[model samples]
Target: MDTKRIFRDFNHCKFLVFTCLLPAELFVSLYLDSVINWSLWLVLLPIWTLKVLVIAGALVGTIVWCHKPFRRNEADGFTDFKAMLITVGIQVLLLLFELLLCNKIESNSPISWILVFTPMYLVSTLSIGACIWGYKNARSTELESLISLNTLLFVFVSLKLHNVIHWNWSVIFIPLWIIMCLPTIVVLHHLWTLAFLRSNFHGVDKQSLVLDTIMWIAIDVPLLTFEILLASRLDQQNDISWVNIFIPLHISLLGLIWSTFGRKGGNTWWFGLREDFCTIFLRICPFMRLYGNVECKEREGGDGSEIMMMPVVTQVVCKSPSKCEPVVAVTHIATPD
Candidate 1:
């Protein structure tokens, strides 16, 4: 798993933090704030912890790099350092936004919604610039789409909150609805394939297909349900409790947490970072080995030393003494020396 490089790589550490802490934080904060009436600061401690750690690390890295730049890889080091500063800047902006939001929610602060959302507006503006630059450089445009939609959603929400627009909560959430339907469409396609095209697959392939389809449903269904419930509650369309509306969100967060630990801890399409914390964690707590068999198989395949310890036996067919019957006998056994 290259445990040595896991912590050294910035992206790996970022992935590890998000995968382990983010979902759990969401669930905990939502539950505590909605049910227990906890202070926003206490409920958001996890986020604060993560932000502090990230900012501290970035500061330390920047200082170290400035003091003694990498002689052999100076260009890469400078580039990474620049990226780290940019990332920390973004985090600081987000923290500011959160502070404004918390103040508004808790103390009934008189900050205008537009003023509170200034950080986001800046981010979106930068994102638009990034999208343009990326397009010119033949890079991905996915971020542009997300930023655009989120900007629209934010504007709609701000208007709704300020009574500037007399739009229903459901109408204000059209961007989210659009986003959710994209994945729902994907899941529906998988279901259709599973129902009608099942004959074309077999064995492990079929099992994998089914598992993937199930995972998609497990994540998407809860998210869709939660969004619908939240909108309904906001619009006073239903008397469902806040806790009830968040139950589906809790489920989805749990699924995300499970997926983080279940899958091989490495770079992926969704999370392009690698860390061995999950592997180490599973080993330390033996009773929590939900995917033990898979881990064992991965370990066996990943290293040749483990495979060399097994004994090899060869079977030979020999004729029996009295009857014209063939008997099987072990001819040789090869063991590790």
Candidate 2:
């Protein structure tokens, strides 16, 4: 089975599921409550387990990259590996903690995340606080801090929504999903940018989006699943049993699994995805490429930073001494290429 293509489809599927699921799930619960409850856990296990295995693999990769001998083979030999280790550590820890906090112990696992919720919340908030402090003085803006803060904020909003708004929240949903999508899109870009970085550092012809697939499924699936489960009428009375909602989502996800990754083809379906929608959402997702590509090979007298000059035209009001039409200044701003 082609796992990578599955990863790519799932990435797009997230937005699809996000857009439709709220209304779809709610509609299912209220009218077709019987179908909603029909052996749902039995069905979700496969994808849920698949998502966990993906994380386990990433953790394994983290350990391997951390090894001195393994690091020697990488692009920077040691420097890049060391930096990636820290990134992986932060990402993995926060992801697991968020999932743990989201899942109720009485429902599934024996360990009660409620006991640790306060601490986990404290850690997420404090990390964002520290990142904010670091961002103010740092020469470069930290993407990690901003992305993490966005996720943390979304989580807070998700939890609040779970408590207050269940099935019948159509009146406020227009603004709600808009607010929710902002963070989701930001995090999505973070993952996309990381894949771009990996492609540059590894010197691969195509970027391996598995890292993003893993991150999205592992982190987002659980978080979203919790909310979906919260809104369902599992315990309420029901009649007819129907097919699992996850089956179609998983099947649609599985059907798209191919080994290929990233933008491909003469058409716009880069990495086997719709270009128009991705452009609308992912146009701002260019962190690693913001300053052009990261070159692993060193040049004789070349500095690391790549400079890009773009002509920026701005309109300015004329001074009183020279009362005239607004002056247009076309200046070339030297920014990171």
How does each model score on lDDT? 0.59, 0.40
Error of 2 at 45 (Å): 3.2
Q: Over the stretch 52-170, how does candidate 2's per-residue lDDT look in tens digits? A: 54355445655554443544554433443333344344545554654564354225655533443544554556556556654554422243554554554444444444554343433
TM-score, model 2 to reference:
0.33
Question: Candidate 2 overall Cα lDDT vs. reference?
Answer: 0.40
lDDT of 1 by residue, 10-116 (tens): 24443455564555456564664465667877777777887787777776665665555443154334434444554566667778888888898889888888788
Question: Candidate 1, 17: how far from true, in Å?
Answer: 5.3
Look at candidate 2 and tell me the lDDT of residue 293. Answer: 21
Off by over 4 Å in 1: 1-34, 71-83, 129-148, 193-207, 261-337
